[model samples]
Target: MKRLLALTLALLPTLATAGQITLILSDKIETSDGKICLYENAVKSEQVKVTASAQCRHTMTFED
Candidate 1:
């Protein structure tokens, strides 16, 4: 299937640049200001940056 092979080759770049972020509830702790906050699992990715905590009860995935 030449067409299928061509299609797959055309999509290779998109797939290579695409990425996902996974956040999982790690802990609940108090801040210095006496406020409660949620902490999520640490994410290490050069393409994604997490600036805030996650308040989800389950795992979450975000694609871009």
Candidate 2:
């Protein structure tokens, strides 16, 4: 059981990055507004609950 658990834990990072999801950040939104620090810059991460929008941009990345 320990070996299996260890394997699953090790694989978690790869699985989490496998699925693609876009986190759109905006400055005008009132709810779910926050900042995400990446590299050396701090950018605002906002809530986007709508199914469709024209101003949102897609951010994508992968993990090992």
Best by the TM-score measure:
1
Task: For candidate 2, write residues 1-64 as lDDT tens digits.
Answer: 9999999999999787675444433333323443332211143333443322333334423221
RMSD of each: 6.7, 9.8
TM-score of 1: 0.32
Tens-place lDDT digits, model 1, residues 1-64: 9999999999998787678656664544544534333434555322222323533344545663
Cα lDDT listed for each candidate: 0.52, 0.44
In angstroms, the error of model 1 at 25 is 0.9
